[model samples]
Target: MTTRTSPATSGFGIEFLGLPGSGKSTLAGHFIASARQSGLALDTVRAAGRRAMRQRLRRSHARFRTLLTFAAGAAFLRSVYPVSKYEIGAYNRFCILHPELAHAALQAMSLHAADPARQDKAGKLWFKHCLRFQLIREEQGDANHVVAPEGFLQKALSLFGYGAEPTLGLETYLKLAPLPAALAVLRLDPTEAARRLTARPRQTPYPLSSMPPDQQFSTLARWAELQERVAADAASRGVTVIDVPSHRESSEGARILLEQIPEDALCSQGRDKRP
Candidate 1:
C-alpha cells in the first residue's frame, strides 16, 4: 500500500457523494479550493466511472468486463449523447436498446431490492468503477490527501448506478474496498435536485434523463433517502461520515463540512515527506 500523507496537517482522504444536481461537484470544487488555500496538499479526483472501470479491468485482466464497459461507453457516445455535452460528460452511461432497461435500472436502485439479476445491465459499470477507485487510493503514496466526488462511499451504497439488486452488497464491497479516512455527504432535497438536473444547460443520458420530469423527481428523492441510509450505516461502522446539507448555499455547506475535518486529520501523520 502506498503511504498517504498531507502537508496540511496529517494525511487524510475525503470524499463527497450525492445525487445529480445535488451540487456534489460544486461542493467538491469549493472544498478543493479551500483546502489548497490553507496550504493543504491533495489531489482533486473526478469519479469518472468508465475510466476507473477501464483501469481496474486492465489490472484484474477481466477481459470480458473490460470490453463491455468500453463498448457501452463508445456506443452511448457515438449514438446517443450530443457533442456539446461530451466536453463535460460527468455521468457514465450503459448502452441499452430498450427504454425498459433504463426503467429497470431505476427500479433496482431501491435500497432494499434484492441482488440484481442483470449485472450486465447495471452492475458491471458500477462494480468496475468502485474497484478502480479503491486501487487508486491504496496505491498512492501517503504524502498526499485525496478529494473526490461520488467515490467509495457512494459506490459501496450502490449509488454508482441503480440496480434492482446489487451485484456486490455493501458488506462485500467494504471487504473488497476498505473505507476511506472520512466522508462528507452533501444533502439536497430531491425536488430541488431534480430541478437542477432539468435546468442544467447540457443534455444527460439515462436514467435521469430517461424518465419524465415527475418520475425523475421520485428517483432523485429516493437517492436522497438512500444517501442518508448509507451515511448512517457508515457511521455505525466507525467511518467518519458527516452530513453537510447543501440544499441552501453551497459555499455555506462546504464551510460547514470543512469545520468537521480535523486539522491534524488532513495530514497523514507525515507518512511521506518528499517535497
Candidate 2:
C-alpha cells in the first residue's frame, strides 16, 4: 500500500501516559523539538493545563463558586448548546464505521437523558475544546502529529482519581476508545517523582505537585498501577507501547523511542504493527 503523506494530514496521534512528574513533558518537549526541527506536522496538548482546567471547571461544581474567576467568556456557560451544534453527523459516521462503540452508553450523548450519560456527554462535548479537538480533527483526516500528555488512555485515572473505584466503565472505555498508533508510558521511581513534584511546588497547574509528600507518593503508585493495566489492555490489541525511562545523562529518551518506532510509522494515520 502507498502510504499517504501530507503536512496537514496526520499519520497518527501519540499519547503519553504515566504518573505525575514521570518526565512525559520532558520526552514530549524533546519530541516536539526534533519533529519540528525536521519539519514534522505536530501539535502537543498538555495533560491538564489551563485549557483543561477551564473545561473541567465548567463541568464541575466550581462553575458557580468560581464562575467569575474561570468563566473567561462563553457567557458563563449560559450559551445553550443544542444537540445540533455538536458534530453529531461526523460522530454518527464514526459510529457507522465502529459499530462496537455505537452500542451501549457509547450511543449516549444527547442534549438530555435521564441519568449520568447525559452529563457525561455534555462534559465530553465541552472538553472537546482541547485534546478532544484532536479526535475530531483526526476523524476529518486532518494531518498533524498530535501528541497528548494524558488523554483517553488515562481518563480512568481522572474519573477515579477523586476516589471512586472504577468497575465495568474502565474496561469499556479502554476497549472502546480509539487506539493511537503509539502509546508511550513514562516510567519513573515514585520517590523520585515525589521529589520532583515537591521541588516544583509553585506550579499551580498540577495539584499533585503541591499535595503532601505522602499523598503524592500514594497517588503516584495508584496511577502507575492503573496505567499499567490500561497499557496492557492496549498492547493486547497490537498497539505499540513505548516504555520511556527517565532521561539519563547524555541520553535523550525521545531519540531512543523514535529509533524503536520509526517516525514514518507514527505519521501514517493507520493502525497495525509498527514497521
Candidate 3:
C-alpha cells in the first residue's frame, strides 16, 4: 500500500481507467509506489468487489458466511444509503441538482440492452452495481484515486445482456461522470493483455471454480471491448492516454504511466462535502 496527502483539498488527483487485463491495476500499483517514493500525498482506492471483499476478510475472520453477509450489507447500503453518504456525494448532489445527468447515465446504460455483443445479463447487472458502488464511494468521501479497468462499461453491458451497440454508447456516458483531476487510459492489445493476465502473479483467495470457463470467456470478451473503447475515448478526451503496446515490456509499460503523475497532484485531498 502507499500513502499521500489528499489531492481533493489541493484540487489534484488522477484517475486511471482501462479494462481488466489492460493493466490498470498493475499500472496503478507502479504509479502509487513511485509517487509515494517521491514524497507525494496520494491514496488509492479500487471499486468495491474483490478489493472490498479482501478488506472485509482482513478485518473479520475469513468465513464464507461472514463474507456473504458483508456483501449483502454493502449492496443494501449502496441502494438505500442517503446520497450524502457516498464518496461521490458531490457528484451525486450535482446529479440531484441536475437530474438530467442521472437520466442520461441511465439512458446511456439502457442503450446497451440492444447491443449484439452482449450476452451475459449477469455481467451487465454487475457492472451497474459497480458504477453505483463507485458513486457511493465517491459520495462517502472515501476515494481519491479511482483505477477503473478497461471495458468497464462494456463489461457491465455484456453482464446485463446489452451488446456492442450499448457498449459504444456507454462511452459517452462515462464522460459525464465528474471529471478527475487527471485521467489516464492505459491501452494494450488483447492478445498481449490475455498473455499477461495468464502470466501475472495471482493475488487472492482462489478457487479454480471461482472463474469458470463461461465466466472467463465473458470477462475476456469484455476486456477486448474495453481496450478498444479506452483507446478511442481517451484520444477524444485529450487526456494523458498511454498506449502500452504488446511488444513493450510490462515494466516499461508501467513506467510510462507512472511518469505522467504531476508531483503536485500526488497529495491526498482530505474529506470534502459529502453528498
Candidate 4:
C-alpha cells in the first residue's frame, strides 16, 4: 500500500504505543534498523535502560547536583499549587528557562495531580510525571526525529485504562496534551493481544494481571477498543497516526511503519553535526 506522508517543519518526536504485548517495541527496533540500512538518518538512543541512568546518577558530583535540582523543582511545585492566574503564567513561561521540567510539571498539574489522591494513585501519577520529563526533554532537543518505544501516547493509554473513572481528566489531557510529530499505534484486536500477552514470558502488565484468564482477556479487549478510539481522536487533532498491523509479520509491519514517515523525517537527527 502507498502510505501518505507529512514532513514536520522542525525537530519532532515519533512514539510507538500499543497493547503491552502487541510487539510495539520489537516493531520499532525492526523499523529503525531498516531505515538505517536504507541510509535514512534515524536518531535513536543507544541505551535506554534504567541501569545506565542509575549509574550516571551514582557519581557523587552528579548525584548531588541532580538531587538539588529535584528538590528545588519539587519546592517550586508545592509553592504554586492551586495555581493563580499569575503563577500559572509564570509556570508556563518557565519553559523559557527550564523547558522540559516546566513542561512536565504543568502537564502533571493539568492531570490534577496537585489535588490529593490515595497512595496508589499518587504513585502512578508521579511515576508518569517523571517519564514525561524524559519524553519532553528528548523532543525539545535539536533532533530531526527521535523515536520512543513508548511515550506520552502510551502513557495516555495507561492513565485512561487504569483509572476507575474513564472521564478522569483523560479527555482533557487528550485535548490539551502536546502531540508528538508521529504516533504509531498497534492495530491488533484485543483477542490477539491477549493471546500474545498470555504466551509472553514477561509478567502481564495489566491491573487485571492477577485475575482469571477469562477476565484478563476481557479487560484487554476493552482496553484495545479504548486505544482505537483515542487514536482516532489524536488523528483529528493533526497527529500522524501510523496504524501498524502488529499481529502480522514483524518485518512486514515494520516496513509499512517506516514507509509512512515522510522522507524529511528520516533525516539523521543531530547525526550530521560536526563538533
Candidate with maximal lDDT: 4
RMSD (Å) per prediction: 10.9, 10.6, 10.2, 8.9
User: On residues 195-225, what C-alpha lDDT tens digit does candidate 1 reach at each position?
Assistant: 7777873754355666788877776766676
Q: What is the per-residue lDDT of model 3 for residues 1-275, given as tens digits with 9 covering 90 to 100?
A: 12322221111156555444555556666666665565543454344333544454445444546657776766776688632233344345445643543554455444544433322434344334444444434443433444443223333323322334545445444454333435556555545545555565373112212455555456556655654664455445544445553223546655665565443334344533111
Model 2 pairs in collision: 8-143, 9-143, 10-143, 10-144, 11-267, 11-268, 11-269
lDDT, candidate 4, 56-174, per-residue tens = 33442354556667556546755876332333333344345445433443344345333344325534543444343343343334334556676556766665554445445556556
lDDT string for model 2 (7-42, tens) is 112323677777766777677778766655554545
Q: Whole-model lDDT, candidate 1?
A: 0.54
Ranking by TM-score: 4, 2, 1, 3
List candidate 1 stretches off by more than 4 Å.
1-12, 46-139, 142-144, 156-161, 165-168, 174-176, 201-205, 245-248, 268-275
Kindly report which residue stretches of model 4 are placed more than 4 angstroms away from their true locations once superposed: 1-12, 41-144, 271-275
Model 3 residue runs over 4 Å out of place are 1-12, 46-94, 108-164, 171-175, 192-230, 245-251, 270-275
lDDT of 3: 0.45
The best candidate by TM-score is: 4
TM-score, one value per model: 0.59, 0.60, 0.50, 0.63
lDDT of each: 0.54, 0.54, 0.45, 0.57
Task: Flag regions of model 2 displaced more than 4 Å.
Answer: 1-12, 45-126, 129-131, 134-144, 204-211, 247-251, 262-264, 268-275
Cα lDDT, model 3, residue 131? 44
TM-score of 1: 0.59
lDDT of 2 at 53: 38
The TM-score obtained by model 4 is 0.63
